[model samples]
Target: MNNADSASQSVQTMYAERFATDLTDNRAEQKELTAQIERLRDRLEQLRTDETWLTGMQAALPGETAPPRPRRAPRTGRKPAETDAPAGTAVPGPRPAGRAKARPSRARTSVKKAVPTAAAPLHQLIRALMPLGEPRLVREVHADLAKAHPERGTSVQVVRNTLETLVKRGVVGKGIQKGTAMYTATAPAASEGDEAPAAG
Candidate 1:
């Protein structure tokens, strides 16, 4: 009976040792799996970051091959006026009180006069024929002007350019017919004297 009890005790001890060995192996496997999962997550995060950076760099380059950049609205602020003065001309600083106002130098004044001279003839011709309702082709206007003033000898191209100038100045209306542009004189605003009396 004593031998049998000792044998049973030894078998129970061996079973406990085998159970402990299995628990340790399972713990090591769980740790290795957790480490592999963490490494995969880190790699995925790095790939996402690299992809985002690459997409941004592709947008900045020009042409159709690259992704389009976000379009910004055009600036609406007034542009600085260009001066007619020569490149090296020094702009005068503000004068002190009681100092004589600096007269515009001859060159500057002549440059101003020259600009008006180029535009004066065109303005005069358009103004003389104000409020014309009929749409006139550039060729017709040129022919009429040449016949009326044989000395001027203005070319058809010059007349077309003048008509375009009038359109820009809001003195004439321009329209397209079969892809060819036609111009009609726009009437001026009626003054108080020109207005009709109100009916009772």
Candidate 2:
């Protein structure tokens, strides 16, 4: 009975050591996985930051659209032996014919239609519409121009573009409203050079 009891005690001690070894190994592996997770998280954050920066820069470019991808040229210059030469003995290809002299292309000159200019140009008319310190939209100016000069033909787009030009020239002040430009005269807008007809 004494020998049996000693044998059982030794077996229990050996099992306990094995359990402790397994527990330690498991903890070490868990720590390694945790560190790897942290590294992956940091790398993912960096990639996201780079993507945002690239997007902003791409939008800022003058040409907003993405550049067209270049197509890969076919391997026409050096074909494979399978196609280049048939199973029969290689026959030399016929000599290339002499290249024809390239004819000089005739330059076509299109006749541009003459654009009718108003007695007073549209820029001057648009400037006349903007009173100093009073901001107006393109549509408003176009309306005013029509009322003031019934004969002159002007569109909203034309007026808007003219206002932008004036803004660049420091003749007008530009503002934004509802994603559209509003313009105001910065200085004396138009010269009153054209004398009004004397009232009866």
Candidate 3:
């Protein structure tokens, strides 16, 4: 009876040791698998970031053919002269030789000041002041007109609104002076056919 009891105890110790070793091996394997999963997640995040950056770059850039690239003017043995455009060929680049002084830009052409006889009273008043030959502020123009022509009784706001309208109409030139708007009257150019008759 004593021998049997001792053997049973030894068998129980061996089983406990085997169970502990199996548990340890399983834990190690679990730790290794968890680390591998974390690495994959980090790599996925990096790839997503790169993809987002690439998408943004693509959005900001113009389409490839937006402005057809200007072909390089073919090189010739002799450099062409300013006036030496070869005949019968479309100038192969951005600008053709002697571009007719690019028609004055719209902004320049439109800045024509004319106070016709039938113009609004405010416009006529502003035009009359053009003889001052300098840009004037809205406040200054308003004060002067009020003082000189009491009957007009124009308000400062009226002057400002009128000035803004005149600027849009190209009848008045607007400039910035000392960070404030300054207005100047522009005279319409006389047409070529309307030249004054020569005095005898």
Candidate 4:
């Protein structure tokens, strides 16, 4: 009877040890699965962020062709001859034989000042009508311009001319509807508030 009792106690102990070992193994597997899940989540987040950045870059650099380079000013120092000057006025005689002609200085004119005729009023009009999603008819534009510049009371012809000029300068786009034309704003106005470049 004493031997049988001792054998039963040893079996119970072995069973408890086996149960403990199985529980420990299960916990280790759970921890490994949790780590793998976290790593996968991190990779998904990284991929989403990368996709967003790629989309922005694609928007910023649309179209296959690169932007055209700005034209450089001519290197010749000669000032344009004053063709409109009256014939009688004593044009300054060429520098005396011994004195060297002074080199013409390069003046850095602000873009706004350079395009004064086209930029200021046009910019004002654009600011007044921002986020212009739809095309505006010539008559409607003229009316808006007149309302904004009541003191000037601009004519339809003038507004049309300005719109055409804006189109040529790439500041505005023209849309045709029913054999008629409409205008739409392009880029933001310049910081110095100049008018858009004039059409030839």
Candidate 5:
């Protein structure tokens, strides 16, 4: 009778151990599943934002004649050139090479106190800022620029646009890690004395 009692106790102990092990595995699985759900939700939000932007862009595509009605500025070409000078001062990438040379002369005449080194193309600065082989966020790059070279005072949007342009031109590689956009240099990182060779 004592032997039987011992056997029953041992069986109950084994069952208890099994239950604990199963419970631990269930909790771990729940944690993993919860993480996956959060990631999916984040990704879905990103996709929706992209979709809305893409829709707006498609509406403005050249094939759409509706855009021409609001684009009545073609009648005043000189006015646009005068207006775009400020845009050139603000963001250099979109302005044409011919306009670029013309814009800087006016900018230097106006904002002469702005650092000469800051006149270096933002794209060039980005090429200089990026380290080899590691992805970096636009804001991260902008922060370093703001810190190390405060003279090159620029906004996060400008940095982000410049990086995206570089990505399209094959001068930089873009990545999205956990819903954040990042860029890495495709060319060797530029040195203090040297500028990166532009991609064709």
Candidate 6:
């Protein structure tokens, strides 16, 4: 009976040692897996940071690799007052503070019949063609000029060209309204006081 009891106790001790070894191995495996998961998370965060940096760099570039803007032109050798005048047009000088009044409205048929020599200056003709406190088309100016000076023969192209020149000089404002180019005089007629010295 004593021998049998000793044998049984030995067997129980062996089984306990085996169970402890297995539990230790399981704990080691769990630790290794937790480390691998942490590494994967760090890699994902790094990738996100790199992506954000690349996006910012793209935004900094102008128009996404657009060409550089051209330099501004040098000033002309002409005087500041003559600056308002168009090329090839005769500008006597800068206009006086007080300008001459426009001619009274006349019949368009009579104005059209008038000779070129009798025609009013182009700038004066344009002003007379314009209405108070509103924008007018080049065609409207041409029509009005015909009415005001029947003898004068001003073409529609000529009127448009003159208006563009006026816009560059800053006396007139140009803008697109309803998909059409419209122009208005920046200064009021009362301030203009009748005289438009600049020639067409």
Candidate 3 per-residue lDDT, tens place, 1-200, comes to: 99999999999999999999999999988985675566556656644443433332332243322121122112221223322443334442224212312432442243232113212356656556654447888878877765554435455676788777766766668999789999887754221112222210
lDDT of 5 by residue, 47-131 (tens): 4443433333333343433232223334434334433453334343233333435545654364444444445677777777788
Candidate 1 total steric clashes: 0
Model 5 local distance difference test score: 0.61
Top model number, lDDT: 5
Worst 10 residues of 5 by lDDT: 64-73
- TM-score of every candidate relative to the true structure: 0.33, 0.36, 0.33, 0.35, 0.38, 0.36
True-structure RMSD for candidate 1:
35.0
Runs in model 2 lying further than 4 Å from the true structure? 1-117, 191-200
Clashes of each: 0, 0, 1, 7, 0, 14
| Model 5 spans with C-alpha error above 4 angstroms | 1-116, 190-200
Over 1-200, each residue of candidate 6 has an lDDT whose tens digit, in order, gives 89999999999999999999999999988985675466556656644443433333332343432111111111222223323342334332212111211211342243344434354467755765576558887767777776665444555676788888777766678888898888888865444434554547
Clash pairs for candidate 1: none
Candidates 4 and 5: which is better by TM-score? 5
TM-score result, candidate 5: 0.38
Candidate 3 steric clashes: 1
lDDT of each: 0.51, 0.55, 0.52, 0.51, 0.61, 0.55
Which candidate order results from sorting by TM-score in descending order? 5, 6, 2, 4, 3, 1
Sequence-dependent TM-score of model 2: 0.36
Model 5 CA lDDT for position 183: 93
Q: Candidate 2 on 1-200: residue-level lDDT in tens? A: 99999999999999999999999999988985675566556656644443443443343344443221111112222223323333344231111101101211211111011123234566776777778989898778877876775445455566778777777767788999889778888878554324222210
| Tens digits of lDDT, candidate 4, 98-121 | 121121112113322324433346
Candidate 2 displacement at residue 64 in angstroms:
60
Once fitted onto the true fold, the runs of candidate 1 whose alpha carbons sit more than 4 angstroms away are: 1-120, 188-200
